[model samples]
Target: MTERAIVAGVPVDTRHWIGGRRVASPGTFTTTSPVTRTALAEMSRGTALEAEAAVAAARAAFPGWAATGRAERARILHAVADGVEQRLEDLAAVETHDNGALLRSHRRGVMPRVAHNFRFFAEWLLTLGRDDFATRGHTNHISWDPAGPCVLITPWNAPLMLASWKIAPALAAGNTVVLKPAEWSPLTASLLADIAAGAGVPPGVLNVVQGYGEDLGRALVSHPGVRRISFTGSVPTARRIAAAAAPNLTPLSLELGGKSPLLVFADADLGLAADLAVEQYDNAGQVCLAATRLLVEESVAGEFTRLFTERAERLRPGDPREPGTDLGPVVDARQLERIDGFVRRALAAGARAVIGGGPGTGDSGTGESGLHYRPTLLTDVAQESEIVQEEVFGPVLTLQTFTTEEEAVGLANGTRFGLAATLVTGDRARAARVAAQLVAGTVWVNCFFVRDLRAPFGGSRDSGTGREGGGWSFDFHCDVKNTVTAPKGWRDHG
Candidate 1:
């Protein structure tokens, strides 16, 4: 059964996109808006059968999609980017409504970034050429080919943007995809399916399935037909997917959790460091690469903490639909409760709540719901405390101080995660030196949250297994083969 309804002023089609068509299942689940706690849409609750069907669709379409020439694929991807631009307003609204991201930020940041992901890889692939080398009597040639049908499982935190990160590269590499979007935020993924098909993507080249991870996710990962699986989520879930994919010997790429740290040196710009610290609360601190721990040089710790706490205090949590809202609610009431639990445990273990400490009373004058947490700053938190070491995916930050550069690096790498880090320092040489020692995959000097799609992105240790973005993703989605030949009367070049 299917129903027509308007959610957050946008019309919604409560059906799954499979085989380039709208698929309505007998079973469905209601998706509620995190901002209003109201039903956004009734999405098809996908099952093992649907998962298999979507995979079959991709498998069926793989030969044709993989046979597409590079220029033709680039043209189609560019068209998809243009289509995303046209739907920016509706996409942003749907994302904010379903995922609780601020409307203005979604419009200003997320939408453009999604479009950029498509255009970047689309153009980048054009520059890629096969390798051919000839030396005297010997010749060698190397080529890249698609890795067959792949499954992309994206998290809820930046739904469409993260999906684009995986989807654009896979398609650019000529791999058909079965996208399993988080049930909490499936609206934009569905819309993306429509946009892609309209952009001249062949039927079954892209499909979207919606449901809980246990049912739909397990089915998709373990499906024998899926050649590659790229996922972004928690470590525990990554482990589960890894186990499932193990039986099939499927290639996997995972970008998992992070307890990333931010280091501020004595000679750093304290004002800018403090501003970046406050910006950690952006997206309610639900980002995977969020610098949740602050390691400041002892010499400048006091001033940095004061400025940081002041900025955290000024953050106003409000409805995501409002233009001036600084912080929106966490994804839902469950996340709100989990955030509260982290704060409570931190307080019990001697961490001081220096600013806007506990859960939101929801009585704040901004018409915000109860699912809000005022930006929280924790001081005197133990290095071993759960709140400090674990992934607290909320608007809460923990603070600690280190006296020397060595100690700062040590403290930063103490956690199992090596996803990302930021170092703020005035000296260029010192910045380079410390960044080299830091265990994180991507280190930023004098800045926070700076990203280039052309750069390699992923983590070390438990953070993730492989990298994404730029040529790394291209390499991941495709298989490399080298062919060697020798002239009629040739000897070994070696």
Candidate 2:
């Protein structure tokens, strides 16, 4: 951690660099404050030439770097952990200021996960090896190795955290990279690139460009030199990345949005589940794995609403960086408008606001200014309500009731998105049965928004394909290169 990195929302540097030298023609763009719409930094957007420079630098370093021993890569990643930990506060503040995400989200959600991800991938790389498999008088030494240069595109919601999800593993797998970050939030990406370069990473191994996805993202993804693309964003954008990847047959891993369901069974712990589920809305339900839909058995819907509303009302919304503020406004004014629009559509179509509803209140998005939305719960929402079908991505939860266990599972799986689900039941048999039947990638028996860097994290259906966290990511970066060989003796012609 350098004292030079110790600053408060200033434009640090703009020249595009490769292997430690600042080069020419770095185009300029201004980064705005999501909180107040003020210009925070004047960044140099990467032109196609600059983008090419990054790709070319990565290409130049690929052979020597990828060919290096995995242990050497691991040591550098291990050093990154110390750098990240030392600068955790700076990172968190910057994330909150740039993305308008909760401050602790970076401290708790991003930082530890970033460190753990680096360490986890470092360990995972050591276990992968090329080995000989002999079968029926034939033998082959299967070689699994790095796939060369990788292009990673991360979302603003969890920028650095998601960056590490791809960055740490791609490096650990021995591939060089050129990362393109969302223009909505590029501070963390730029900071991370600087950190990686400073943390003993040989230059050209990592590159970053700050700009709109349409130009920069397209250039990075469509480039012929990129071997693999790892993207985390919306479904539409993922589709675009897929199309760009089609011509080159570039390997891809997409992690998109979700409309997760939280099923409340008759025999479940209503009080506890309601507390945890709605309590999470303080972060304005921006979490991808949040219980966006509450599907309760008819026998428990009444009880579920009672408990959920009681807890939801207690959550306070205000400035995200503040200590007592549980819920901040959604990321920006656009998101706040979208949240309002989603609720209006639901209300117009015959849904009732059971608890805090309408536009944001208090210090959150005031009637005329800032970005904030009230923690709201909508009941009596038609099963076909837009709120029910689409991801609100705000501090809102829609409710629907089911009669049987089968009905609950059917309703949960009925949506196009299947990212996460929470099943609450006292009986192990019932929990086990329903958890397995759920369509989501992850099913929490009684928990909500819980995560571990060492666990496989991803979704099914429109939520997107591919898994992150753990050593599982190595598969996303490195390809299976099975080498055919025989033991010490020559090719036996016996």
For all candidates in order, the CA lDDT equals: 0.90, 0.77
Query: 240-353, model 2: which lDDT tens digit per residue?
Result: 999988999998888888888888888888897787668557457777777788888888788788888778777766666776667665666777788899998888888899
Model 2: clashing residue pairs? 143-481, 143-482, 143-483, 282-327, 365-372
Whole-structure CA lDDT of model 2:
0.77
Query: Across residues 1-494, which tens digit of lDDT does each residue of candidate 1 receive?
Result: 55545766778677888898989888999888888789888888999989999999999999999999999999999999999999999999999989899999989999999999999999989986666898785788877799999999999999999999999999999999999999889899988988998899999999998898889899999999999999999999999999999999999999999999999999999999999889899999999989999999998999998888777778877988887789899998888888999899888888898886777778658858788888888999888889888998998998899998999999999998999999999999999899999999889787878899888999999999988888888889999777778778656699
| Model 1's TM-score against the true structure | 0.97
